[model samples]
Target: MAGRWTLARGVIHERASALDWAMDSRPRSDSRARECAGLGDGLSPAELSNLTPRAQIAEEWERVRLPESDRKLRVLIVGGAGVAGRNTAASLSKFCPQLQLVIGARNKDKGVQTVSTLGGNSEFVHVDINDFTSLQAAMADSDLVVHAAGPYEYADTKVLEAAIESKTTYVDISDHEGYSRRAKSYMNKAIAAGVPAITNAGANPGVSNLMAATLIHDAQTENRGQPQKLRYNYFTSGSGGTGPGVLSTTFYLLADEAVTYHQGEEKKLKPYSDKRSVSFGEGIGERDVFLLNVPEVASARRVFGVPTIDARFGTAPFFWNWTLLAVMKLLPVEILKDRRIVQFLSKFAYPFIRAVDVISGEKAAIRVDLECSDGYNTSAIFSHQRLAEAAGTATAAFVLAVLEGSTKPGVWYPEEPEGIAVEAREKLLRRAAEGAMEFQITKSFCRRKEKQGMKLGWIN
Candidate 1:
C-alpha cells in the first residue's frame, strides 16, 4: 500500500522528440518544425500553434544547458509572516540549509518573529507585495521569490511582473484559476529574461497536479493505455489551521463558477454542485466532495490531454460544508463576488470556524484517480496531519528543484514536462511526499461482464 504498482497493456509512444531538443543548442530554422518539435509528444498541432513565441522558447529551453552558479541560492518568501509562508521558510531552512532564506513581509515585527522561530541562516525583509518598488527592491538581492500571499482570487500579477523585470525565478502557491492563467501569460516575458517561473505550486493545485502527472508519466513509460478520464478529490478537516485567508479563499471559490472538461469540451457548472463521495483509502475515508474552481482542472486537461477532468473539495465539521452550500444558495452572485463583503463575512464566521477546527483537528488528503480505455484504474494519494505542513513541504520541494536547475527558463505549470522533467519527476515526488502520513500509488482493473446483465467484476 505504501509503494507503487505498474500495469502494462498499451503501446508507449517513443518519448517525445523534445527529449532530443533538450540537449541541442543550435536553433532550428523551420518555424513549423521548431513549433512541432518543441511540443512534447502527444500534443496536437493546434496545441503547438497556440504556443506564443516565448512559450515555445521556454519549451526548448527545458533541455538547454544552464551555467552553474557558485553563489548560494537566495529565496525570498513574500508573505513570510503568514502560516503558509512561514512554514515554507522553515522547511527550506531545514531541508535545504545551503540556500539563504529571506522572509518578506510588510511588518518588520512579524518578519522578525518568524525569523526568530525558524532560526538559521534566515533573515527578514520588508516587502509589500502590492507595491512594485518594494517588491523590486527585495527581488534585487534574491535569486528566487516564493509568493505565499493568500486569497489569490483578488491578487494581481504585480509580484510576478516584478520577478520578470528583476530576472529572478518565481514560484507561487496561487489556487485561483484566473490568476494562474494571468501568470502563464507572462511566459514570454519570463523566458525573454531567462527567468523560470511556476504557478499554482501549492498543495491542491501543486501536489494534485503532480499526482496526475506521475500517473500519466508512469503509464506513458510503462506502455499503459492512454488516460481518458481524471478526477481529483480532496478533503481537509476544519480549515486545517490555515486561518482567515484560507476562509476567504474558500468563500471566493464558492462564489466563482466551476470549470471542468467533459467529452473534450469545457463545461461550466455552479460552484458547490455535482457532489460525490470518494474513499481516501485508509486513515481518511469517504467524504462528501463538491465541485470547486481548482486550477488543476485546467492544467490537467491541457497538459495531460485527458478528455474528462474535474476537481472537488470538502471540509469537515460537516456543518461548515452545509453552511457554505447554504451561503451559495442564499446569496446573490454580486454580493458573493464583492471582496470587501466576503472578507467581512469571513471575519464574522472566523470564531465559529476556529471552534470547529479545535475539535476536528487539522488533517488533509488528496486523491487522484485516472482511468484508461483498457479498463485499468490508477490512483495516487497524499495525506498529511496538517495542511500547512503539507503545502509548505510541497512548495519547498519545488523550490529545491528550481534552485538545483531542474526547472528551465520560462513560466510553467507544475505538471508541465518543461516545468518538471520526467527524469526528475520521481525525485520531486519523493521530496514532496516527505513527512506525509500516507503516500501511495495503486493499480487495479475493472471489466464489464456483458453476459450477466451488465454486471461489473474487478481483477487484481
Candidate 2:
C-alpha cells in the first residue's frame, strides 16, 4: 500500500501560491515518488531550482525532520479505522515522517490496512474505547492522542479521562455539543494532569471554527464593533465520500434538536428542519443548508460572545437530503437515540452512500459569516474537492500545533486562544487549506450565488 504521499488534489499544498493551487489535479507518477523519496537530506541550489513547485514544498516539509534524539514522538490515533482518523494519519505521514504513528483501533485488519499506506514508522495497536484498561495502556505509551472515534452523541469523557490519566496531549474530532460539554468538564483534570486537550477538531467544527475566529478577530481588532450575528454554513457532496463514521454521525444526529442562539437566547429546533440557501463561493455556488446540532454553535456563543449564532449544513445530490428528512419523519426517537441500531443502519446504508458519492463527487465547502454591530460584515470560505482530505488536513494542523507547544494544558474549543494561539492561526489555516480549491478570508460578501458559464455540448 506504500505510495506517493499526496493530498487529495495531488500536489499543491500549504501556503502554496494561488497559481500552484490552481494547477491541474492529475497526480504525480510512482517514478516521481521514488525520486522524491530517495532525495538527500538537503538539496543544492541547482537541484532545488530544477524541481517543480510541488516537489519543492514536499522537500521543505521533509526537511523539517525530527532529530534522532527526538524521534520518539509517538502519536496514538484512536479509531484509526474511521474515515477521519485514516485521513489524519495520511496527512501526518505526508507532512511529518519523522515521528512514530500508532493506530489504536479496535479493528485490527482495518487499522493494519491504514498503517500499510502510511509507509514506515507506523504500526497498529488494538484498543477498545469502552475497555478502560485497553484505552489507558495505549495512551500511556504515546505522547499524543487523537480521538477520532465519534458519533460523539454516543461518546463519553472516558477517553479524555484516560488521556488525562496518561498525561498525554489529546485532541478529538467530536462534533456533538453534549460530548463537547462533557469534555469541557474535564478541563481541570486535564490541566492538573498536564494534558493539553482540544475537542471539536474536525473540518467544520475544526477549520470552520478557526475561520469564524479569524473573521471576528480581524473585525474587532480594527474596531469594527462587537459581532452581532454569526452564521456557519457548510456543504458536502454525497456521503462526504468517507467511511461509516460520517454516515453514522448523520444518522445519530437525527435524535438531537438543533440548537441556535438569538440575541443571547438559546433555541432548540428540529434537526434538518430549517433550510437556508447559502453560497459557498465559486466552485460550489449556492446550496440549500439546514440547521443541525453542531458543537461550534455553542462554542461561538460561549467563547466569542457573539449575540446571535446558527450553524447549518447541506449535501448533494439533493435526493439524499430528502432521504434523511424522510428518515427523521418516519423513525422513532427511541430508535434514532439508540446507537446500536443507528450503527447497524449506517453500515447497511454505507454501500448506497458510496454509490451516491461516485455520482455527486466528494467536494465540500465551508463558509463562516460574521456581522458586526458597526455595519461591518466579513466571511471566510474554504472549499475542497474532497471532504475526507480536508478533514484530515484540519485535524493534522491542530495536532501539529499542539505538538509544537501552542496549547496550554486543558480541554478547549477551536475558537479559544488556549486551543489555538492567535499567533499560530495563519499557519494552521494554510496547512488545513492545503488542497482546497478555494480558501479566502474576504471583507466583501463572497456568499452571493456567483454564476459560471455553462459548457454546452457544442458550445465553444
The numbered model that scores best in lDDT is 2
**How much lDDT does candidate 1 score?**
0.78
Candidate 1 lDDT over 6-80, as tens digits, reads 111122123222322221212345664455344435656554443222222212212212236687678899999
Clashes of each: 1, 0
Q: Candidate 2 on 203-245: residue-level lDDT in tens?
A: 8799999989887887777777779999999999987767887
List TM-score per model, in order: 0.83, 0.83
Q: lDDT (CA) for every model shown?
A: 0.78, 0.79
Error of 2 at 197 (Å): 0.4
Weakest 10 consecutive residues, lDDT, candidate 2? 451-460
